[model samples]
Target: MASKPPDILLQGIDALRRVSRHMFRYRASIIAFFAVLLLIYGLYLRPPSDFPAGKTLSIPRGATLAEAARLLEEGHVVRSAHAIKIATYLFGGGTNIDAGDYRFPSPINALRIAYAITVGNFGRSFIRVTVPEGATVREIGALFALGTFTAFDYDAFLAAAKAREGFLFPDTYLFASAVTSDEVITTMQKNFLQKIGQLEPLIQSSGHSLADIVIMASLLEKEARSNETRRTIAGILWRRLEIDMPLQVDAVFGYIRGADTYSPSLEDLKIKSPYNTYLYPGLPPGPIGNPGLAAIEAAATPIASPYLYYLTDTHGIMHYSLTYEEHLKNKRKYLP
Candidate 1:
């Protein structure tokens, strides 16, 4: 209006007005497109409607992210494998996912699943079970079976862990309610290796095979409750082995007959089993029970002592003697 604005300026204003009208006409369509994208993204984040509730999904060890995502999809745990992979890649900071059995009792989002696997946040309730030192494989199996949440298969555990008796480290473990026998065995054995790995130098320098040390420690574990007594007993046992003397440990009878008593009857000593240290002149064929770290260390580094005979009294007190006559006297004094 002021001097009839220049033609070029008028043309620019006309172009701007045309652009605004076009945007206003198509505003609803643009919003709908964005809403559709958001809906799709939200669906990708949710669990599949057919999710396998109360089912265990096993992720193999060392599985790649792609493989894990595929397994989650196949297990009906996620709506989209790609979404989980993206979520993990973004949030996990490129860490390896944990391998184990995962149970989803209810629906969970893909982001949650990603976080769980990345951080080993297994959603299942864990049952705390303590495997006592000196427990045999059978005893360990029974202990696990006693848990209300464990639904543990006693026979399967015994069968699988029979050969791994002493190698299965005894410790307090938190296991899933539906843990399998193989899983339990693997966990204990893995723990054993990890714990023993720390003492590798000591074990190597002791001039004794790991097997022998474990067997000796098993005996020490059953014979004495204190580290000092165990070390003393270990020295005595090693000296006896040098002279080819019978170990004559009564704990072997418990392994053979499944009896809890440490005092074997006169007849029980005569049993022909190779595990009978009284009948056999060397270390038992294998460890009678799992041993703790203190017992293991005592076996590896036995104290020098003159005592050859030792016994535990009814009150759990230990008596050490240099000769058989003194041992008998202590036995009479301490035994019931």
Candidate 2:
């Protein structure tokens, strides 16, 4: 007689068969679930790698992150297509990446690349340029060319900045290597507008035209070094204009000559240019150079004084005189 199978063994076999039947019935669903998991793993969790040497990718303007990812993968700059998009959407600050030409020289991670493009780290070199106060357009052009700040034509910059003199705020600026002259002007002009907007109330209430105030400020920039001196000279200059006296400021000669000299000879005064303050009364046609906020403020709000004439001596001390003879005496005594 064969030994009877244990009851426990039979129960276990029956349970196993039931489980197998259910699995067979849902085989397609099980396969689909695992396939989805594999797809997600490949697209997101995969590590990034460097493309073959010399490979480059071009992302067109207005392209979506998904499209950018596709192009990057096609160029072999990335290992996954949807990974970069997801990374940028999740981790990146969602800044609209600036549209421009980009260069990829070596391997960079997806997150890093995303951030770089998002913030416009174009993988090219950059330069920091500080346009000092009172820098003429010609001087600014030379700075850009000599410093290799960008591939800008000096003549072109001068032509563009000519109309924007005194409107371009002097400040330190960072620029990419491939910036154009027009782009530079736009940046500086925008900065000027933004900065001057802060003084809008004062500018409007000063009772002086914008052009006149700017002209006065330009003179103040070359006239004095300190805020106190700037205000004092501003008063004297405005008074001269009020009384129909020629400004007789030597700074105007520097503008005419395109030189930075502040001390003009008697012959310079004879130059027939309208910018010659000694020859023409009232403000010049336009600003001589970009002036700083302090000078602008001084020009807008000149301190009233009883004195009529002022001069900076050899020792840089300012001397004030109430009469023409006194002014002449001070000039001879201190200027010598």
Candidate 3:
């Protein structure tokens, strides 16, 4: 009592009391506002929790972002479905997310994952298959039957490629596991067209139809191993055609039987088939196998030679003779 309280002190006390009262009156609202801010920050910008790597996530075709989020949650790829949806909605390039099997080999952020899906990054892994040169359509179908691609149907592939026998180019190819038969056929055919385009001018001026060149090339593929040998054989075969002589190649027997044979007997040659070049004059009805670019080129530009007969021996050496007697002598020496 004694000393009167300072006016300044009284004023300071009044201000502090008023401020405390205001805080108490809206305490719940203030708490809620901070909570909402924290949630928003976590949903939009927080790094996702680390998960064990090597997980595969599959999103079906035409899946919405919400559905994808649920799938991710089920796979344990992401922690919260709601958070994924919200984050994707805000940062995803677009609403459309590409649907396919995706393998997460390492830890990745949610934002990056969303971006990858939106941009059609299905985490592409290729099944590499090698189709050897001169492979037949049936052989190629068998390869597809044993391929890693789960959706590759051997019967469907056979049906699709039956009519495309010599036109299906043989080469190593990489395709997704879910690739369709039609897609495989189309790709091989397109590759054939593109590769043949390089020899268009030569084919045009060679005075032989494209089909004829292909037929000759296919024979060379089976007959010879090197480009020079192919060219020489091409000349001998072409010379035979000019004189109305039969090609008499053993490779046609393999084609007719749908099996490979090193030596065809006289009885095998007696079988009546249009592909039997031994009986028929000139080229066969069609190609026997898919020939590579080198063979095709050799057929288009054969090196002229005086020799009329040729054969490969046990040591892989080619013998050429101009006379039938000489040919028979070399054959007896090398073959027997």
- Among all candidates shown, the one with the greatest TM-score: 1
Q: Candidate 2: lDDT of 254? A: 85
Q: Kindly list the per-residue Cα lDDT of model 1 for residues 220-328, writing each as its tens digit.
A: 9988989998999999999999999999898898899986555689999899999998878999999999998989999998988999999888888888999999999
Each model's RMSD to truth, in Å?
5.9, 6.9, 6.3
| Model 3 TM | 0.71
**Which run of 10 residues does model 1 get worst, by summed lDDT?**
143-152
Give the best candidate by lDDT: 1
lDDT-better candidate, 1 vs 3: 1
lDDT of 2 by residue, 171-256 (tens): 99998666678878999889988888877788898889877888899989998999988998998898998899989888888889
Candidate 1 regions with alpha-carbon error over 4 angstroms? 1-50, 61-69, 78-100, 109-121, 147-152, 197-202
Query: Which structure is stronger by TM-score: 2 or 3?
Result: 3
Global lDDT scores for all candidate models: 0.88, 0.81, 0.83
Pairs that collide in candidate 3 are none
Question: Looking at candidate 1, what is the lDDT of residue 10?
Answer: 97
